[model samples]
Target: MMKLYKKYQSLIKISFFIIIFLISNNCNSQNKYEILKSKIENISQNSTDNSKSSIEIIEFLSYMCHHCTAIENILNQWQSSIPADVILIKIPICSNKKSEVLQKLYLTINEINKPYLHCELFHMFAKEKKSITHIKDLNDWLISKNINVKEFLELYNSFYIQSKSNRANQLAKLCRIKGIPTFVVGGKYTTSPAIAGDEYECTINTINYLIEKIRKE
Candidate 1:
């Protein structure tokens, strides 16, 4: 009886270790590249036009958000390396007074084809602690940069810029964006460095994984 009881104890210990080993392996087998379906969802059906078939990458952001500012350099580097099949689009959030000013700045700067100044604007906001909330303040900043404030104001308040800003707001709503610095891939997978385990590289790779998965499908 004593020998049998000792053998049972050994069996129990062996079973426990086996269970632990299996659980560990099962977890490791789950690919990091496999993002949760709950984390990403389909926004819309893809267009049938192959010309527009390129994977659309939309960044829902706000210039006033510090997290958005932090990813600026990473975004620039990623854009330069993006494949030809990926089209990156920036949508500024204009839900408030301050964001409205930023939306105008982005659209105006883009219209003028001076994206180089994007980093400068970020620096002004994040580092220099500039307040661009007021039009006068924005005008002063533009003048300091050698940009014609009058001409900039003319374009900034133009009907074209207003329409663009309105469109951007609509796009953000469609994406169901909950926060700034959100990256939506193929109009389905929405993620960020924070969402991707606080790893910017993970966010980038997850985007690439989704793009490739879409291409295969």
Candidate 2:
């Protein structure tokens, strides 16, 4: 009877340690992301559709931001491998006149269906150290790309582009986005290199962790 009691006690001790280990891992996982509150409440509240099963990962970035440029390549690579159920949306921060122009540039690129120009614009800004504070700065470059300057300018100044640029700015303000290269994962968690760690890869891991966490839920 004493032998059986000792065996039972040993099993209890082993189970207790296993439980502690699992709990520790879970805590560590949860520490990777921050549970957002008002910063992202509008995203959920304003969501008009429930039929969508795909997860959204919103990246708040600016072409003029050095950190955004630094992480662009890694982000692009990650986007290529993301699951079909995940959607990545990039919202350019339009806080100032220069950034607002860049934001319209992005919208105009989308409007004209010139997706490749996104990378070219980034390359020009980051690699060439070029500054495009005004819309006219792009006139020469646009012509070089064989893009019709008149049509592009018309689209850039159109009411549709203006509305989108204003909306982007308003969304940034609503989310209280104070820094570039920040990411909102599944609209429930917010993480960035500054929030996760100095290493860009840590931000990516945190993003992936949040994505998997949302998927499980």
Candidate 3:
């Protein structure tokens, strides 16, 4: 009888430890991101669409902002592994003439189906320290890239590109985006590296956490 009681006690002790371990692990998993509530703000309290399952993550950025250039690699890597339900939209903030030109340039490249040039343009400004202050400067750079300068110039000056650039500017204003590299998740919550104590990883974690939060809702 004593032997049976000892075995029963041992099993109970083992089960208790297992339960404790699981509870600890669950708590850790819930708080793994250490997301700071202050780092994110609610932009919209409106109800999200129940019919659409996908989420849109809009990134407001500008080529003139070095901070935006710095996070491109990490952002691109994260983009590559994103789930199919998430969509990343990059919008250039046109706060001035130079930025307006860059915004048009981005639209022209997309219209021409040469989206790869987007990274090349960033490399030119970030690494080469090049500036396209005038149409001539942009033409010269396009020529060096072996792109059809005449074709690019035509599209760059087209009304379609102008309209797209204008829309981007308006969207930035609507979002009240005051800084580059600002991320708006699901068009409702806004966060950034600056908001997350200038920590890129924290910003990413915040983004992922928000994504899951929206999914659950």
Top candidate on lDDT is 2
TM-score, one value per model? 0.76, 0.79, 0.75
lDDT: worst 10-residue window of model 2: 42-51
Better of 1 and 2 by lDDT: 2
In model 2, which regions exceed 4 Å deviation? Answer: 1-29, 39-51
lDDT-sorted candidate list, best first: 2, 3, 1
Clashes of each: 0, 0, 0
Worst 10 residues of 1 by lDDT: 27-36
lDDT per residue as tens, model 2, 161-187: 888777777777766677878888877
lDDT per residue for candidate 3 within 155-204, as digits (tens), equals 89988788878877877777778787898887677878777666676677
Residue 90 CA displacement from its true place in model 1, Å:
1.1
Across residues 1-217, which tens digit of lDDT does each residue of candidate 1 receive?
9999999999999999999897555333113333334423333244553435577777887767788788788888988998877877787878887789898899899999998888888888889887688878887888888998889899999999999898788777766777778887776567776666656666666677777877887
CA RMSD of all predictions: 8.7, 9.5, 10.2
Q: Candidate 1: lDDT over CA atoms?
A: 0.76
